[model samples]
Target: MTPPRRFRAGRFLDAAAVHAAADANPRLRRFMRTVAGHGDAGEVRARRLLEHIIRHVIDDVGDLHLGNAVARLERIAVLRERIAGILDHVLEGGTLPEGVRVEALGESFDQLRTEMRELSRPRDGIVGDAPLRLAEDAAAYADSMLREFEAGGGAAGLHSEPAAAVNDAFRAMPADRQAAVRRAAALEPQALWRAVASETEGGKRAAVADLETRLGGRLTPDELSRLRTAVDDLGVARNRGLQVSQARLAEALARIVDPELRAVVAGGDVWLTQQLALHNPEALATLWRRFRDRGGRADDGPGFRAYLRHDMVTYGRGVLGEYTAAFSLSSIELFLKGPDANVKVAGTDLVGIGHDGWVWLVDDKSHRATSVGGVSALTDNLVANLRRDAADFRDAITRLQRDDPGFTPDPRILDAISRMEDAAAEIERINRRGSAATRPARISRALEERRLRLRVTSAAGEVREITQALRDLGLAVEPTGAPVPLPPTGGR
Candidate 1:
């Protein structure tokens, strides 16, 4: 009886050759050194080094006779497989296999090195063209092998049961179906993951089933099971990441003192929660310092607004709802005459009357300050809103004075309107000439200044401005002071 074919460890030979080349070849040595020194969170450095070596070898092989090229391609395929095995061993903390000698494998690369050097030297034009064609064919073969290796997840993926299963399913698909799946994956990765993580088992099965159907029933029962297992693994990994992020965010919020602010943070919108959870705590702390440096005070409106602006600008709209909730204010409605009938318009993000009947209008602007275009749009919107509010306030005050005769309009309200008008004018000027020379720098500086002014004059500024206005009106007014018995938990 014929003996069963024994598995030969080609990786030992591949690893020896790579190490030997690093010592002999200046280019390869520099690459290996750079890769060794580079910092990577996991086995990424190993994977990149492996890919670079494979490409380098393919490039060096250059052109050969058809028969020689075919032989060279086969050798490269065997070498890649062995390299992957070596990577797995290294990543798993195993030393290189004993008795592997560089001299044994160095012969394999010697001919390719000679060919590469010869290609660089000027030769007969007709002869050079023939080598060039052969070189292209060899490169194509190398690329095909590389794609297959990557698709199988290199050496590390071979050990992962889920990844192995996924590869099995991927390989089972026809070439066209595989291409289609790749396209779909590229277009909507999040959607694909969501489908895999469907709440119901039936939904999950159906999604996979649909995928199989799209692939023209290419997936077998065993392959389908493997795909399901792989999907579950991916879902579990994603969920774990989200949980860790949420815990970090919760820990950060625990440091906050005010119950209202805590509530705001706790009651964050989905976008805000995701942002805060993933956001670096150290970065957040740095921003907090900047806020304090900019005259921000905790438990105050300006402080809260500054925090919101900084967080929003850095991390996007994830912190908007929670920070906006820091202010306890009433929403108001105003009536306006429309072309067809009377139209009721909602006031700004927050509106309220102080003890002395001084009205305050605040538009959070969380939406409009997230992007460059949003900044420009914000200026326009703020100007329009301020004008409308000022007109409405004037009309209402005039009506009150006519009706009571004893009613005295607060001069502070007029002053606030005037300040808003001036701010609006400045914003408009900036918007119009914002495209002049040094446009980006000018716009960026203007935006920063405006953001600072908004933080100072809006929430925090509103608190101080209203307080002073009440005192001027001969009404006893004091700050709300911090809320008592702060919640033990961050939020409800």
Candidate 2:
């Protein structure tokens, strides 16, 4: 058979009726409190019992099903009966009657009645929670009863509440159900108060504090405080962000490298600071999670929103430090690829593609790249190679002019070469300045010019022009007037 279809309208009406009953009677508070502490099986059973009680309580006192409801209550009345059995067993064991059997069961009934009354009452808005006073009271009362019973009768408190609770529970039902429920509740009054109180403190505050600290101040006071109170109550609520800014920083720290890049990154505190500066909270959160989960790498750029005024150079260097040696080698490789491509030199990582290049070799942590013969050694080597290539090109051009004097090459080619040389010079100046902000424009433009030349200029012409350009641009070039040799392949 299909489970009962949830009638939204009926549920709404039923809820309203439950609210009405709780508001009108104080006994509902006791009932809810008792039911809360029940074990899973007991709680489930109690929930069913409460639902039945609520339906009966509101079922017009004269309903035809009233008699059946009373009979049903009698069938499910286990709490009182079970406690009575325990009390009898304890007496038989020759163990002095511990008040726990009395107080615990007694308070359980009290809570049941109180909760029932609270739920029965209606409020302006539907208040799912009844007052917590009864739970606290029940707990204290249960504690006292257990202690007295443990002492063997000197302090066995007379638990009048269990009988009263059962009485109240039945009384709250339709009047027709009360007599039958009363008859079925066969609880022993002597051992109803015996119960072990549970401990509440769980050392969660320190754990919460430690977690919050690691979050790098990303967690709000409200969020941290909420976690500190109870882990079970945590919710994935909107506006309640889980702070992971520090985690992102740690991630970013493991990926980037390059000194100039490090310098660019060092000026700022963290990616989160950059994010805050941009005033983009969503981007900040996304970058944080990405950094935390994927790590800080150049390829991971898609996940992290670049909001830094300095191009997140510090963050980049932190990431670079993770593979400092690898990045330095890669920098040299890039610089060796071409003389005209913009090259960025910073820390150990070299960025840029041509003559206008930025070299970044991150050594912020190791500080090795900044030292002499470190990244600077690589830079000097690159400059010297450019000089050698220039000398070779000049000699080749001189050979062509001599061997084929009739070859009056296009002056436009020479002009283009001259322009490239000029750009290279500008790039060198920018490099000396070591300012990433002022360099990209010149570097980017030079590469565009180089690309144009690469397509338009002759190979020999390009080599000749680039070498002369390098020499003119304040770099150490090979001696002039060197002899030019024929191509090794004898093919221009």
Candidate 3:
């Protein structure tokens, strides 16, 4: 084995401890039981799948680390993969035969041995035999399997895939030798995998002795089925873990960016981060740079420097809420942008709604609300446009109700719009009252107050009253409040 690097010893030891505990913990035993419930076929398949993942992580990602934590991670990952895969497969409604399981486990053990050897390899110039430690560990595991096997005494009972398969192969050769093969099989496969997974100093030896004493053999169909069920339960555990991982990773990654950007990006203020995550990590990095530049970091001019560095972590959570809202808004955008033939927009009041309500004003391409338009007459026009659009919507709904067999115009929506139109019409009427000779700029405050107190009799009533009050007072109603507030009665 290669001499250990100074940097690797602690982590390696840590990994070893975790792996060992995981291999023998009662939790894993229960986990196996849950997988067994999935059925033997599924458990076996899951084990195989887990083996594949471990190999990939270790060979690919772990190897990249030059036998540091990355390499250990590979082994750890594989072990977890084996455990989780068995659990998931059963839960997902898959199963494998006992023989199939034995072969799969054997392969996993072989790979683990190879990895442990590398892990034990000398980092500096020292030549240490890492495989020796693995072998010693394997022996303990073998003994445990033997004990477990002996307890069963070669009767058709549940054994790990490797143990069962090897026994089956031996039994087929000759009845007398069958018992010997079963005992040896228990020693070889189950114990080996257990040792590979086990990290406790002497746990592997104990496991092996247990196997030897158990005198285990091939599992019956029922045992296999139980194992499969147990494996299936693991899927639920895995999925739950995945959600937590995603949330944490998101939080961690978000920390690397500016606060406002994080807020806008995470709080759902903007679709930018959502878009960025969908692409590559590098793309997200680019957005981070741009966000900083916009905030004045690039030229050291007027950027949001203070916010970028500090406020993000502080305020990121609240912004995440905003981010969720933004996501919904985007969904709405798609409905508006797609198949215009099914929907259409026109007139002034349609444009009058606030930015949130002004669906069309929110840009699909840039993922931004219309920012260029000033917040004055243009806003008024937009509101007016919205009002008009509301009217149009009412008409459209009415038309659909009348023409389409399946159409049913929602009464609540229609009523809401009718109320809005009535308000607008009332404001217009009130404003017109200003033109009358007797009342022109002459209406008393008492009368104006009385008007404000009057019942919101219909949708048009409030707007009319406001318009009339403004014109009579010689004040610009449009520049003032466009939609007058409903009285204490809740409507004008």
Candidate 4:
């Protein structure tokens, strides 16, 4: 545990805390569960795994301030208790996932851990990380898109820029309507009417009809028709102008060079599937197979990282959520980043080392919770993309089957596909009923978090009862219990 350089109290303590936190890393615990053995072999194997998990976490985080061998060995001793529970479960015939070659598992874990390593190596800054300006513009665009999505537009509308949509629609409006709106606006300005315009194409039309009603007595039927058309055209143009400002925000995200920021900025499932399919193809397939065998399927699909990002975005609206969190903590004397590798490692988002050297580690929820893409776009993206990617996985599997006819999907994966299809359909149903006014259910979270729990209980007498039942049914049932019946000894 290398302490923060300022508090050179001991790096060993920092190492201990890092080890403790790494011990909680899901990959390690999942591995421990996989290699559960009760006796000597189990403990030996468990210690080896503990060693790998701790070393790998520190390595990936690039923090070398770990405590000495004695501290690590002691940490191993503590981890053995977890192994003991795993062994007990295994010894009781707890079904485990099919074992992978340790090398494959290790390689996969290493790659995945790289994805989790905080990308603090700033590409944009002069000294270190250039402080990123809050993406308020992207947030505005997303808000307009969300309003559109709420007003009976499909989830696909999330990508349609309000400015772009209205611009195109206005160009298509009738010429008479075009001229009428120009004259009406020149005389009495529909600034307030335009204010309500960009919600969607449907919303703009509705606003036009309202304006026509307010001026009911003034025009001939043809004149009214032209007036209505002209007013909506101007309204849409106004909305487009506003969204043009908002649309500029999309660039802040697009211009981003960092992969992690881009991924979360890009939305959760989209990033997850792209990374899995592209960067971690080998790791993805391996983890997918491993997770399937262990009973993980569908949205619970192979990506643990995706699940974390979704929760982050769901809670934080994404723009400067951490800055808002940190603003409360900072003073002229406070450190900007976590300077301690052991207690407060590099990835620590907000580190408040008080003037007295009291290191306050604040886990900034906003890191994952908020997004520059706006809340509605981010939320629906997870819902939409999870369904899309699962279908993609199935299509790939089907294509593989075509190449090698004997290839059959793990039953769990098939089940996952079915559930994903059903959930996607359900979300569409919710969208159709116009219940999308409030947040439509997050399909990714539901899909990813849904678990099929199977419980097995061991009884003291079930084995004996089975043996007796077999005997009664006229079958030779051997009773091999303690005081084992000696085989056919002649009178001896």
Give the candidate number with the greatest lDDT. Answer: 1
* lDDT, candidate 2, 467-487, per-residue tens: 323322222211112222212
What lDDT does each candidate get?
0.43, 0.35, 0.38, 0.40
Candidate 3's displacement at residue 221, Å, is 72
- How well does candidate 2 score on lDDT at residue 448? 52
Which segments of candidate 1 are over 4 A away from where they belong? Answer: 1-323, 326-373, 399-405, 422-452, 456-492
TM-score of 4: 0.21
Ranking of all candidate structures by their lDDT, best first: 1, 4, 3, 2
RMSD of 2: 33.6
Q: Please, what are the lDDT tens digits per residue for candidate 3 over residues 343-445?
A: 1133221111223332232211111121122222112333364366566676777788789879876554555455445544544454457655553333333
Superposition error at 389 for model 3 (Å): 5.8
Backbone clash total, candidate 4: 22
Best-fitting candidate, measured by TM-score? 1
TM-score: the better of candidates 1 and 4 = 1
Of candidates 3 and 2, the better by lDDT: 3
RMSD of each: 27.2, 33.6, 28.7, 31.5
TM-score for candidate 3, residues paired by index: 0.21
| Clash numbers, per candidate | 4, 98, 116, 22
For model 4, give the 10-residue run with minimal summed lDDT. 452-461
| TM match of model 2 to true structure | 0.16
